[model samples]
Target: MGIVIKQSIKNTIITFIGFGIGAVNTLFMYPYFLGEDYFGLSGYVLSAANILYPIMSFGIQNTLIKFFNENNKTEHELNSYITYMLLIPLVFIIPLTGLFYFNYDTIAAYESQKNPIIYSFVWVIPLIAIFMGYFEIFYAWLRAHMQSVFGSFVKEVFVRLLISVLLFGVYFKYITPLEFIYSLVFVYGMSLLLIVFYANKIKRIVLRFKVPKQSKAIWTYTIFIILSASIANMLLDIDKYMIKHYMDIDNIAFYSVAIFIAMVISVPSRAMHQITYPITAKLMSEQKWEELNELYKKTSITLQVIGGLILVGILVNINQLYLLLPKEYSQGLFVVFTIGLSKYFDLILGNNNAIIFNSKYYKAVLSLGIVLVLLIVLLNMYFIPHFGLNGAAFATLIAITLYSLAKLLFVVLRMKLFPFTYKTIVALGVVLISFFAFYYWDFSFHPMLNIICKSILVSIFYLGLCHVLKISSDINFVMRSIFNKVFKKQ
Candidate 1:
């Protein structure tokens, strides 16, 4: 818990810095500098690549974490394991590359049916996908060694800061829109290189051709992971892809802005997961059920308290935040609310995903993910036509809510574990009370100042209530430490 708390707090700070930069980019630069059409095009290209990278990596990223800490393995066996992780993705990447090369024009034509500018950038998808795939692979390698802060910095801060520079290049008339789009390939490639370098510095990656004794289990897990991961990514990015087909490309940009706001709620979950995932894997592998259940509750409440504050802050200040955006972008307010609620639900699940993925019943969860993807796609098709951007968001909310519930039930029923207690209920109460209390009480000032004042108010009120209620001792401990440092300085 000490290392988890220490690294998670560091990762949280790093992630916030990254998201701050990202908020500037997503909320301001992309919209104003690039214009809506190219912004939408950029969003489309990235979404399509996100959907593809899971298959390209062949699930080696996840497999690396799950299998890396196998007990009683010699140095030679470990090297062999790492070697297999390195080489397995080539099985999918090579064939896919050849396929894309031969049928490039036909695929481009299909993608460009609704949005023609997308035709020229079609080839960039697989190139960036390759970069993203290996980046995750190397990041997972670091996580296996219980080293994630540098990778977090690289991923959360480094790549985004580069993108900001590229955005500025466009603003200063130095790069064409097409060049900016193409520059993303270089950005992701550099990110991959940095993570790979850092991973090697931690442990030199040696390639040994000999397969481990658990080769059969490894292959089985990898195959399941590939299918499961593909389905999961589809559930996330499919709405954007569907939007490109059904709506104007500019609509993707509008929806992306709202989605970005909603995504901030998940930052705590993301920061904590980087550390908890490998720990969850280790515990399950060792069959430490009691310790695993305790971690489950602790992570759930901790994330809930942190994530709830973020959600409440966003909801209460959503109107003022939108006033800062272009009028056309305000159409996504419902999108923000709908998706924000869904993301909050996901945040409260703690390490539910890690538990399911590492458990033997992972196949069942994979089947459930497949069904949810189909459900989301169908809902998007039906709703986007009738309701537009809000429709896509609503469909996502339904699918994600159902998906979260399914995972929760599967974990509880199968493993007889749950991630709730009285504190969970108290956290929810505090969030709801804060939202209702501050939502309609905006100050009569400039929108930026109003947001600042209101956000501070919400934080103090939210954290104050959490402290009084003792919702999370971990969070309370952190708060006391900060106060102690501040008063000592004074």
Candidate 2:
């Protein structure tokens, strides 16, 4: 818990700074400078790259985290493991590169009919995907060593900062929009190099290139991770992919904006999970089920209390947020609500994903993930043409809700532990009451001013209730530290 909290706090600060830069890039720079079509084009290309990342990396990132600490192997054996992590992904990467090269024209012919810009730079997706794959691979390498802050900063902060500078270049006519788009590929490539450099700095990695004793199990885990990661990425990115197919790519820009707003709610979970995952793996290896269960409940309530506050903040002030965006993006109001709810629900599940994925029951969830992927694709296909962007959001909300519930149930039934308790109920009740209390309240001030005032008041009201009710010891610990500092100053 000490390491988890320490790194998570660091990760949280870095992630917030990253998202703040990203918000300016997404909400202000991209739309203002790139315009809707190019913004949508950027969104589509990145989403496409994200979908390709799972395939390119072959799940080496997850495999490394799960297996790295489970054994006390020799240096040679560890080197062997690292070599396999580096090499095995090429099994898919090489062939996919070849396939893209040979069939790019035919693929572009089909997609370019929808957006001809895609045909011109169709190769960028695979390029950026390959780069991001290595980025994650090295990031996992550092994370397994319990050194995640630098990697998180690189991933969440450095990349966005680069993008911000690049967007400014485009705005000042120092770079054309096409140049800006191509620079994105370069940015991802640079990120890979940076992570690789940092990873080597931490532990001068040597590749022994020998087979480890656990080769068979490592391969088995990698295969399942590949399947699971593919399914998960498909569920997350397919909406943007499908949106391009059904409507003009510009709609993807609007949808991306909404999704970004909703995704901020998941940052705390994302930050914490990066550190907690290996710990959960360690716990499972040690067969500490009781300790694991308690960790699970604590994470659930803490994330719920935090995510619930953000969710209410987003939902209550969504209209004011839209007012800040271009009028064309106003259609995404419901998109924010639905996707925000989905993310908050995911946060409430806490470390259930880490627990399940690290346990031997991981393959069961892989099976479930496959089903949900198929279901999400079908739902998106059926709904997007019918309800448009909002329909895609709805499809995601339903698929994710069902997927999370199934995982939670599996953990509960199989392990006899649940993430929810009386505190969970109280935290949710506070969220709803806070929403109703402040949502309809209006101000004569400017929209931005109104948003700020409402957000501060709601956070005060909601967090006050959670502290009073003792919803989470972690939350109280943080509050106590703050109060102690303030009173000591007085």
Q: TM-scores across all candidates?
A: 0.99, 0.98
lDDT of each residue in 88-147, candidate 2, tens digit only: 999999888998899988988887787787888778999999999989999999988899
Scored by TM-score, the top model is: 1
Evaluate model 2: give its lDDT. 0.89
With a 3 Å backbone cut-off (N, CA, C), the pairs that clash in candidate 2 are none
lDDT of each: 0.93, 0.89
Q: How many clashes show up in model 2? A: 0
Off by over 4 Å in 1: none
For every candidate structure, what is the RMSD over all alpha carbons to the true structure, in angstroms?
A: 0.9, 1.1
